[model samples]
Target: MRAIQITEFGGPEVLTLADLPEPVAGPGQVLVDVTRAGVNYADTHQAENTYLAASKLPMVPGGEIAGTAGGRRVVGLTADGGGYAEKALALEGALYDIPDGVDDMTALGLIVQGATAWVMLRKSVHLEPGETVVVHAAAGGVGTLAVQLAKAFGAGRVIATASSPEKREFALSLGADVAVDPATPELRKALIEANGGRRVDVVLEMTGGTVTDQSLAALAPFGRLAFYGMASREQPSPISAPSLLRHSTAVVGMWLPHVLTLPGDIMRRAMTELFDLAAAGTLKVVNGGEYALTDARSAHEALRSRKTIGKLVLDPSR
Candidate 1:
């Protein structure tokens, strides 16, 4: 099997294509002949060894995969890290049968990015109907889905923040009521103004540092900010309980891996709904770019550049 293995922790340059022996499935795990794999922001973090969980050395770089197992089409997360290869291993419980009408990439979208958006809106923030929602990085994979999902969840308004006009326009096309530039001189003001001169009720925030601070400032009373990722790789100013109490606002941290561990069908339910939406064409799954298995490095470079929108995948068959 051909795989992208990283022996050292560093940048995208560390990901190298290599020929390795095929992996055999152990008990409770199924071997998947991978056709496509999902690339996520966390994959980049894993590559740099700065992810929430530490990654072992000399490992493949992807966790989400769309493949066939036991002659059945499936999409799932690899138990450890073998998704960046021609074949990988996944727990039987982790894999989901792809529904009819849902393509590999669409099913792949729900595994991580789509599920993250669903949990962030439904569980983390507990979004209510008619509440204003703000989605940052609105042109990226999770952002694109969050914008549409917010609207589907009956949000009164959706404000999208991206880096460029084109990206913002793309966000608007995905049901964002308004689009603003995250680089505005007064981001807080811009966010509020985008929300019709009122603070937002819920926010899906990822970019860290100033964006976090400004997003917090733009929150309305009793607003909830779901802080998920720190794409900027910069730390935000310390948040104090007193400040939160004074504003009656909450900052809830959400990680998909943690949610997947809870004793419930939360992840399964979310993935099923996301897949159904995509299959029904109610949700648009943006196909950012499909890179050949060997061009995994190029995919990482594009993601790090923050200029690409929607889900990026690697085609193992390529």
Candidate 2:
């Protein structure tokens, strides 16, 4: 089996293609013939050993796989991160049967990015109908889905923030009511204005640092901000109990991996609904680009460059 291996912690340059022995599934796991592997921004952090969880060296970096197992088409997370290969190990309980109407790329999108978007809104924040929501990085994988899902969940207004005019337009095509530039001189006021001069009810924030700070400032009383990822790799000013209490705002953190550990079928339910929505043409899956398995480094470069939009995947068969 050919796989992209990382022997040292660094940047995308560390990813190298190598022919390795096929991975064998142990108890409670199955071997998936990798067809498509989802590439996430977190994978870039995983490559550099800077993610939420420490990553062991000499390992494969992909987490999501959409392929066949036991003669059944499935999509799932590679718990130990080996989905960049021709074959990888996947937990049986974590696998979801891909719907007939959903293609491999769309199914792959639902695994991590889609699930994260869903759980952040439906579970972490408990978004209410008619609530005004702001989605950051609106053209990216999770942001794109979050924008559409926020509307599907009956949000009164969806304000999307992107870095470029084109990306903002793309977000608008996905049902975002307003698209503002996160890099604007006055992001906090921009967001509030986009919401018709009102502090938003909910904010799906990922880019940390100043964007997170401004998003926090634009929160309404009793509003919730779902802080998921720190794409900027910069720390935001620490929030104090006094400040939160004074503003009557809530800041909730979400990591999909941790959310998956909870007792219920959150991931599965989210995946199922996301797949169904994509299958029914109610949701859109934007493809940034697909890279060959050996071109994993290029995928990482593109994702980190912040020049690409939507979900990126690797075709193992290539």
CA lDDT scores, all candidates in order: 0.91, 0.90
Taking all chains together, the TM-score of candidate 1 against the true structure is: 0.98
Q: Per-residue alpha-carbon lDDT of model 1 for 1-318, expressed as tens digits?
A: 899999999999999999999998898789999999999999999999999999899889898999898889999989898899999998777789998888898888878888999999999999999999999999999999999899888999999999999999999999998899998889999999888888889989999999999999999999999999999999999999998987799999998878768888788999888987887787888999999998999999999999999999999888
Report RMSD (Å) for each prediction in the order shown.
0.9, 0.8
- Writing each residue's lDDT as its tens digit, candidate 2 over 1-318 gives 899999999999999999999987899888999999999999999999999999998999888899998789999988699989999998777899998978888887878888888998898889999999999999999998899899888999999989899999999999999999898989999999998889999999889999998999988999899999999999999999988987799999999878667888778888879988888788888888999987889999999999899999999888
lDDT of 2: 0.90
Model 2, C-alpha of 160: deviation from truth (Å): 0.4
Assess candidate 1 and give its lDDT: 0.91
Give Cα distance to truth, residue 86, candidate 1, Å.
0.3
How displaced is residue 161 in candidate 1, in Å? Answer: 0.4
In candidate 1, the residue pairs with backbone N, CA or C atoms under 3 Å apart (3 or more residues apart, or in different chains) clash, namely none
Q: Which ten residues in a row have the lowest lDDT in candidate 1?
A: 256-265
